[model samples]
Target: MVADVNVFVGQQRFLRLIDEETWATVPAVDPVWVDVPVTDYTVRNRPKRRNGQARTGSYQRRYGANPSGHPSGNLVTPLYGFVNEDLEISLAQLMMEWGFADHEVKFPRSKTAEWQYVGHDNDQRHLGLRVNTATLAGSEAGIVLTLELIGQSSVSFTGAASPPADRNKLVEFLFEDSTFTLGGTPLRVSQFQWSVQRNLDVIYHNSHNPISMPKTQFSETFSITPMKSNKTYDDLRDAFGMPELAGQLVLKGLHNGTGDTGNFTVLTIDFDRLSLIDSDESGGTGAIMNPLTFDVLKPDTADNGSAMTWTEAA
Candidate 1:
C-alpha cells in the first residue's frame, strides 16, 4: 500500500523574514532529489463454471456438463513510483539569522493523525513524517537522527470491507492506528496536524542602523506533503544512513520558492519548545546542523528496501 504523506510550510514567513529587494537575489538552494521504487501485488479467485446438456431415451435419460476446477491463480504486480522533492531548511541557521527564539518555531511530524493508504484500490499503504532537530537530541551538538520500527503491533479494521465505499473512514483509521516512539517515549498520533495556510517569513534589517531608509522583509509559505509512502522510523533512519535517529531539519529551498531552482539554500532552525501528544510522550531540544557534517557521521548512500506490500488471503 502507498502511504499518503503531506508536508506544508508558511510562504509568507520567509518573505517577511528576509530582505524584500534581495529576496530574488538570494542564491538558489539545490533540492536533494531521490527516486523511490514502489511495488504491489494482488490475488484473485475464480468460481467454477458448468455447461448445459440434454438427453432423451425410451425410458429416461439425462446429461449435464462436468464442473471444471477453479481457474489458475494470477499475480498482478506494478512498479509504484514517487519523488521526494521538498525544500528543506537548516533549523540552526534560521534561528540565529532570523533573530527568532526557539520557542516560536513549530514543526510537524505527520500531516494528520490518520495514516494514508496507497495502491490501485486503497489496499496498498504508505506513511511519512517531517523529521526535525527535536527528534535527534535531548541536549547536545554531536548526534545522529534515526527512525526505529519498534515492532508490529495489532491493528484493528473498523472501516468498510469494500474499496471506495469507506475511503474517508479508511484514511481516518490509517492515521489513528499508526504510532511511534522517540527516546523510549511513545508519542501520540494527534501531533501531526499543521496549518496549510501558513508560510515562511524572513525579516531582514540593518544591525547597526536602526532607522534606515532601506528596510526590506520577505515572506513566503511553502507546503510539504508526503508524495508517496508514509515512511516509518526505520525507513527514515535508513534513508539518512544513521545508526540512530538524531539530526536536524533540512530546508530544501533557495531558488525563490520554486523547486525547479537549480540551487539550494540550507538553514538550521532550532526547536526550543517540544511536547509529546502521541502515545510516546517524548520531547527534547534539537538544533540544525550542516548536511555535510551530518552526512559525514552518516553517509547518504544507504539501502532503501522495497515499499511494504499487502494482500487479502483466502
Candidate 2:
C-alpha cells in the first residue's frame, strides 16, 4: 500500500489596498497583486507494501524442520519485490474568468445658482469616466516552475538486467502530464529534472543461504523550476479588443526548497535573468517577467529543434 502523496504551496503574504466601505461590505477583498515567495511549494511521493501471507501449520512444520530432518509439507516463499519510478512536479498557468464589470456615471449641472458649484465648473462639465472592476477569478496558469528531486538513491536488483536503456524515457513519462489537485483545481507540469546515479551496488544471494546475499543501494536527486504566466487586467482587455492601458497585473509563484529537502538548483540554458531584464527595455512588460527559478528538462520545442519553449498555463 503506497502512502498518500502530499504537495503544498509555501506561505505567501502581501498588502492589498481596499476602499474602507468596500471592505466593510464584501467578505474579503480580492488581491490585486501577489508576490509568490521563494519558499512555498513542495512535492512528496512515497511507496508502501503489505505483509506476506502467514504459513500454514503443515507448511511451517515442514519448512521449520532441521536440515538433518526429512522434508514435510511443501515449502512456501514470499514472491514479488517492490519497484518505484521517479517523482516529479510541473507548473502551468490557468485563465481566471469571472467577476468583471464596466460602467459609467454622470452628474448633471443645475441652472439655478442657489449654491455655487465648485471650481472647474465650465459651461458644461463633460466627464469621460470609465469605471471597470474585475476579480482575480481565473485559475493560476504557467509552465512548470521548479522540480524538487528526492530519494535519488538507487538500489540494485538481481532479477532485472542492469542499466535499463529506457531510463530517460521512464523519467520523461513520469513528469509529462503529471497533474496535482490544488485548491480544488488541477495543476499540470511544465518542466522536469533528471538526476542520474553513476554507481550502483548489486548483491547476490544463494538459494541455500539467503542471509549471505549481497546488496547495494545508491541515492540521487533532481529538480526543475516552472515558468510563470499570469495575464493582467490590461492583457485581458487587449485580448478582447479593448483599449490598452498603463497599469500592470502581477502574478507570483512561491516555492520552498529548504525543508529536510536539498538545495534548489537552476538549469536555465538560453534566457537568464539578464535577458528578462533586457526585455523590460522594449515596449512589452511580459519580458520583464520570469519564473523565480527553473530547470531545463529537454530541448525547447520553439527552438526550431534548437531550444525548448516553456510557459505557464493561460
Best by lDDT: 1
TM-score of 2: 0.16
Worst 10 residues of 1 by lDDT: 11-20
Highest TM-score model number:
1
Candidate 1 has a TM-score of 0.17
Write one digit per residue (lDDT tens) for candidate 2, span 137-222. Answer: 11223222222212211122222112223222111112322333222334343432222121211111332211211112112222
| Candidate 1 C-alpha lDDT tens digits along 109-192 | 211011113321222111111112112221112221222111111122232222222112111012222333333444432222
How many steric clashes does model 2 contain?
Answer: 46
Off by over 4 Å in 1: 1-110, 120-133, 137-262, 269-314
